[model samples]
Target: MSTPKPGKIAAQFMAHKREMRLSPAWKALRGNDKLVLERIEEEHMAHGGSTDSLPVTFTDFQEWGVRRAAIAESIARVEALGFVECVERGRPSRAEHRFPAKYRLTYAHGPKVRVTDDWRKVVDAEDAQRRIDEALAELQARTAALSGKLKKSAKQRAEDRALQARNAA
Candidate 1:
């Protein structure tokens, strides 16, 4: 898979902002939380379909102008909202270097929720009502025409029967 570009990642994030905004958890997120989320998303996107957890460091957030304390708080808040999951906590041992903490996005990672069929019905109810009205009008016209033909046929049959009776008499 091609690496996810920053431009592509930003575009995707912007597209889903509306749906994100609607979520209370997302709305409650602070600037630092947003920064952390964005950084994680960018890394995830760059990873390009890798099921493996993304490796990130506090320096990553620092580079983005987020403070260490803010990163910790943001991570907590993000994890609380079920948006970011910390896969492995990197151990910074004095003797050896360890991998940065790994993370991933939860189900809320995709583009914003769209108008599903049920919502579409509610939003376009008036248009649907108009179409139903047109169909009813067509049906009414056809019914009127059919009823007129039936009446004519019945009247003709009565006349024929009466004539036959008169002739017999």
Candidate 2:
């Protein structure tokens, strides 16, 4: 038995995870299946991941040089493994529901990682330099306070001496 190409393997991984999430068996497992999730992400990234798509389509597999037989056999094995399922969606070819379905993974078993709006912002080069300047100014003020620890305003010095005199009594 020959191994499937990386792209097909990645699609298989996504299909399996999606099936598991929608399963009652998954709830019973209590997320002891985190390792499986990790492995899927690893394999997916290995085939050049991006912010583009998930469970790469059959056409993508062809583009990546996966042999036709391997693609068909892998798809069949994946379906047999309960990873892929038939659902009613309007596909571009054949009957309305006939297509390699899309895949999704809900990270329900762990802490969700959020992509921050700051990351999405377009940061100008000059704004970055301004931030650096402001941070440096704050650092300089703190340093000055530490270096002049013994120095005080007139009101402060008078209060200190009065306190010292009262203590001496």
Candidate 3:
């Protein structure tokens, strides 16, 4: 077989990490955790790792295997990614181990979260929301167009009726 591409390998690695490695499950959850963290950093212009610094918490990150390690890793990774890190160490004896080190959203990496080239212009809450809104608007517009097309089919009945009348006449 031809040599596998580097990008393909990297993508596979990332997919596996998301699918298996990270937990609490929401540790890598898509938007809210992802987007909210981004917003907090933009607002602060600095890494806000503590509750005092950053206002948001890792809302729904659940506990899983090697719970303590997972929380710490999540914090470090989130921090490394330039988002605020919040750690609330849950009681050791508590059934849930991932309780204490609660992660929070902040400027994850000190004062800089890298915005991808295309995303630079729209790196704030408003921008992110706007992007979503624009997409939804496009979806709505397309839906409306589709509805209009469907409505045209109703006219087919009228055309059929006229055709029959003409044929009879």
Best by lDDT: 1
Model 2 agreement with the true structure over 41-87: per-residue lDDT tens digits: 44345444432223444555555555544543443322222222213
TM-score quality measure for candidate 1: 0.52
Candidate with top TM-score is 1
lDDT of 2: 0.40
lDDT of 1 by residue, 1-169 (tens): 6777865652333234465455555655678888997788677666653544778888888897788866765676666554666789764545467578887666333333222212122224354345335544664686599789999999999999999999999
Q: Write the per-residue lDDT of candidate 3 for residues 1-169, one digit (tens) a residue.
A: 5777865642111012242223332333344345444444443333332223443323323321223324334444344333344444333343553443334442133333322222223344554455445544664686599789778988888899999999999
The lDDT for every candidate, in the order shown, is 0.63, 0.40, 0.41
Q: Give the TM-score of candidate 3.
A: 0.30
TM-score of each: 0.52, 0.25, 0.30
Task: Enumerate clash totals for all models, in the order shown.
Answer: 0, 0, 16
Q: Model 2 reaches what TM-score against the true structure?
A: 0.25
| lDDT at 73, model 2 | 40
